[model samples]
Target: MAKDNSRDTGKNTIPKKKGRQSAVCANPLYPCAMTGAASALAGISDMGVIIHGSSGCYYYADMAVPDTLHSTFIVQDEVIFGSAERLTEIVESVSKLYNKIAVINTCVPSVMGEDIKEILADYDTICVDAPGFIGYFDEGWRLAVRELADSIPINNSNSNTNTNTDAPLTDLSKDSKGNIRVNIDGVCSMDPFHKGSLIEATRLLNLCGLKTAAVFCHDTYESITHPSPYSVSVNPDYNCADVMNRRLNAGARNSTDSLLGPDNVLRTFEELSDRLTDTEDAEIDIDISKIESECEETDEILTKEGDRYLRRHDPPRVAVYSTYAYTEFACDMIANYMDGEIVHAAARNNPPDSDLNGGENPYNIGGICSLHRIKEILSKKDFNLIIGSSFEHAAFPDSAFVGLTFPIRHRKMLYDRPVAGIQGALYLMDEISETLENGNKKSN
Candidate 1:
């Protein structure tokens, strides 16, 4: 990136527009490309991220990401004289501390145009060009992961010996052909429900006689040599594992659909069953039975207890503030559990409206969605039981809320709780049920 020795105007700048619809709502609560890169890099246990920008820029990005980020405070003097020497000094100093390092270029340093590759040529580091203004979080993280894939030679040399030797890819390739070797791709440990999602996918696969080879971002170590040809991505947006799946040999399923909602999650496992076994009818039957049982258990609890609560007090209007995929997923589950209608749903990031319509309205409202926009919609259409992150929870203190996304800091999560699969759907039913019952008790 070129180094510019001038006043930076775009660091926290949000271009003003005519209305809420017209307003440039590029940066929401979600991370920019730089933050996504930094946060994603931090998931590599002892990996360190060096933010190549001003302290102010670093601070804002650092807030959402839990990892401790490294930064050489670029002052006015360094910006004027060029901070090449200073940046190298910090990189050298910080390199000894981490097993790996990612130098992330934010808006300021990117505009300044520092040739980082030449500077860090000698060090064991990966320089990522993730200008904050260029893209959103999804794009940023993909670039970082892509860079990680390109630079980090994942050969047997530095392979984590500690990695589970239960289902070695070499042995599976030779013996089983493709019976059990499965890798869960896309869902990184950076996500709030990532750990839980990993556990659920592995658990479901194991139940169906499938042995998970590895989870790309969550797994111990990923080698340059593709471990397993067969792979599944948890998020449709995430493509790190998908890219590797293309080069895989025969007898591999390279589908990259998300397991965000229960329906898709069920389909993901079914797809795996088919790939692993030629005659998977028995396995599919057993899997379907388990899912049916789980759904039944949720229904019994809600029907017996939930109906009583609604009888005493009117069902509250439901509103979900989440991503498009997650919103659809949660809305489906909520509709199944509650009699009350889903009045409103606001997406943090929207996939084009043309695609969403599909000749039918999914009722997704987006575009520079601020607190005011949310309130503006809510005033016209009253809602109850807000389902989203802590931000929405704080905004609607009067309404019953559930932690569905990020900033779930206050809630004490005992186990790795999921919000995706059968268990996740049941968990939501339980949470909503409890909230309803409690509200009834208070009212009585």
Candidate 2:
């Protein structure tokens, strides 16, 4: 369990009462950073993940990852001597099953000062120091990527020449056939929406005649081992500084918005099209036209369903608590499909750079929200539709509840369904419309 980074500031002079709200699904008392780190590593197929800690730590992380994982179960005796021998055994076991391995450090082994790097230095391995107590889930995920980034081999001929120069290490474009293939970043299989997000991204990319080189951290180990000079980001939080499309960083519109709606699908094509400078202009337009036609059909279906929804039920006052992209997308669905308004929003990860919570922006409710502070805000609002984790759903039993975030016990779906892109927006709106109709509320 990670400690709350916030210290007990001066005590509030006035005490507040715990309101009569329904007991929402309770969050785990303590969230583990190790779980996030372990899950990230497990997403890569054929990559063996060794959780370096006690068996219990292995169990906890395995609950999230669920496959192709190794555990160094350092017993009490081994703790007294060292975990080196046990780790060696685990590595040997995993090496046979996997071509590459990642050593994820947990609290026990990390605290005990195990020589993990030294022991695995010669092997195809990267050691990510992701002790649970150090940070939160976001930090842990980024740390794992950073650690792997440090160890990833660049096969550029200019690698030696650039080593001593003042140039940045990440700029290996000289060796890259940039824009030939696309790498989709930030949709990890560990996320509740990972599978669906990846599927949608692949579909959208393929629609534009783009060949996917790799879906970073969500594909087989063989796929992720290689690097591309460019990638399209599904989430803004993922580090895109190295291989991201720089041409897309224009002042046309907010970058985050380009990850949410049908317009975003078009934007992605446009951006990637610019990078495909070698392609004939006529050919590029043809590809873009094909993708745009698909979105048009999607829009037609959604618009028809949305019209029926407006006729069937009153627009529910909605509030969303999730990532910025998820929140904004849900808001778009409601306003377009159900004619509803988002009364409030709480962003779980990085705060949005756009006008999500501004008065003019119908898509938002609050300025910025964290997991720690969102509960209080949700309790005070009068929203009838709540889109977020099980916790928020529990708080608003009377509201039209939809779970878009994680730890949702009631609905466990394995199918690929994106909350972004043309299909994603339509799917989410259909869910919202159906929930409203079935929840015994009618305008007629």
Candidate 3:
């Protein structure tokens, strides 16, 4: 898809990466304060957060994750310089109203040079700086976990406290087997898939008497102090894993597939179990080969559907707008299934780059800054298929749209259906099939 932005004929079109180098550069800001607040609130013994920003921020927050617990928000006046004062007032008010551990989260104010720490330093309650500008929303969740961990009083005399309080597992340099904590990453209010994942992860761990130190999500920050609680991370992401590793000495591992899948969960547990076992006879009973076989079957289904779609709608152009990890997997699988081409892809600049190397159709467009641009690109051209969150409306305002879930917040990857490995291939094929059928009707 192409849009005619006013061209600078004499200058290079694509912006250069890294070479514009000065010796130093400021790191990107966190994505949002609400993310951190969600993580911290999840971890507290009994906690709720007071978001200090516009009502829009709260609206997005409400939609971001599951409300397993109660949450309240306080909209601040942009004209007011001391919104932090309003935050203090809300904290006190919420503390009395809810009768639980309370945290006050500063929103964009965090980047505007607001002194959130100084405002809450004497409040006798937990207050964290959750600025969205510093990083992605996931990072916000992790920072909140760090703040919640800091809030815990590590009473040295209280020997009963055997939780992870010292440092992240990476900092301690402990062997993977000896370490016994697992941190779940990619937490935000928008997705609750991790909740089911935690249950499954715990169940698998219990088979070998292993325990999860904690289940970190938009909630689950209190466990940050209990380094021993986590042996490895179940859903590690760039946004939060490093903090857990370097600061808490907790083990951080991710799901086998970045996209959630139950088999991946089972395999992870089985591997951990085999590693934890000292006996020569101990072996993993969960056959990963079975999962692989299942994945192949799903792939076949996807291939069939994709081929069918292409046969009817030849040489289909497709665009994907999603998280980097999830999008790469989705695009690769779809490409293989259809034996077609992906003309464009839009995603965030999250890492480990291996996620994107689909081996077939390489992604042409990288990350998009605004959804509006996506809309413009899609509107100007024609793509037979689009896989993404509903935000594609910005790019293709009039195109028929369907939402595709990548297990970002659900407890299960396919939310009860087998969607990972080959199951995911089949599930995605079905999703696209439905979209194509519906999309064709509307387009015609």
Candidate 4:
């Protein structure tokens, strides 16, 4: 990010495009990303997200985390007429309606032109105000976590809150001596499943004595309880956690670059466990010999398949496109695992000349360069596999494509399978292997 926020362009608001799809910005601003990140941080059982936009954004979150439940949603009608009052009413209603903790997230439409600060100020005494457009999903996540952290009075003097309900999700043992306060960051959809990575993440953290304070996404409110001095980001990206760490006077670390592959996932768990548990030699103990051996066998099959058909047959150049850096990392991992080259990696909605001045985590990769340049690169690139969401596939229909569970669509549950860790590894291996095999058959 290189632009100065102080430079106020009078017409600087994101301009609306002209088309049937003109009502929305195909490239989401900071708010959407933040909302999604915050939701990811909030965890699964005790968190809920209210997208103060149209139904689409809420659906987006739902699709982003299929297993994560969004208990509440405020629609466009509320957004159009300054839904703060209704928002407050809904917040109060939600506070009483459910037993779990709740957080409200605003959308671009709610904050793009309106003084949401003023609107939220009135309700400041009552409920937290999550302005959507202040930043991207990571920023929204940071704000939500900060608000949630602030909401819970941090009493480091007390070892543990004996109140079972107040215990962090990582504190399942309910022991005061072992209450590890952990703030999770750098979470995104994995090769297999997003929530599976999260589940595995929480498990590893618990093993390392770190109590998860929050799991951001939908309906996971670990943020309020795990107010420790250290925040651990499980993924390679740590923009959201860093922002929260700064605001909360804490330290942070990003464990690994990608969290999808079994090896990467285990490494992340090991690194995070070391950081969060303050341990020296506690390596991850997942039994991966079987998976690794299987991968070797799969590699052999791929080699055989390649020789039978794809070898020297003009390997399909691929472009794995998305706005999420972690997602891009996932594609990178897949390409690396399969010995395929990523001809082009795109960040879909990154603002040009974006800056990271110790603010919310600038996690996505699109901000690396201009969209036109990315488009130009794509136009000239020769790609056969366009593996991402349908939205990404739409941009390159000429290529053979396989859609992942991105934000815009529902998890089709094609085979009732999870895709993170070893499962995710096998899924891609199967996809590419089958694709190569089919191509061979076609060629024959």
Backbone clashes in model 1, listed as residue pairs: 1-113, 1-114, 2-112, 2-113, 3-112, 3-113, 4-112, 154-224
Clashes of each: 8, 4, 61, 41
List runs of model 2 lying over 4 Å from the truth: 1-31, 157-180, 239-259, 278-286, 352-375, 395-398, 440-444
TM-score of each: 0.76, 0.77, 0.65, 0.61
Tens-digit lDDT track of model 2 for 354-394:
44233244543332323444455557767666778776655
| TM-score top scorer | 2
Model 2, poorest ten-residue lDDT window?
A: 13-22
State the lDDT of candidate 1 residue by residue for 213-308, as single tens digits. Answer: 656665433332344545655545454665543333222334555566555666666665555444323232224456445545655765665566
Taking all chains together, the TM-score of candidate 3 against the true structure is 0.65
Tens-digit per-residue lDDT, 1-444, candidate 4? 443222111122222231111122223422254344435443545444444445666666665444443433555565566556665665555545344544444455446455544555543321334544454454444455556545544454543432233334333222356454554555543223455556655654555445665443322344334334333443434334444334433433322234455556555555544453453232323333443464456556545654544455555566655444444554655455455666755443332232222333222233311233344456777666665555544555455665553433423544434344445555655665565445422210
- Model 1 spans > 4 angstroms off: 1-27, 97-99, 152-179, 186-190, 220-227, 232-239, 247-252, 278-315, 352-361, 365-369, 409-415, 440-444
Tens digit of lDDT per residue, candidate 3, span 323-361?
Answer: 554566567765666665676675544334443343332
Flag the better candidate by TM-score, 2 or 4: 2
C-alpha lDDT of candidate 2 relative to the true structure:
0.61
Residue 296's C-alpha lDDT in candidate 4? 58
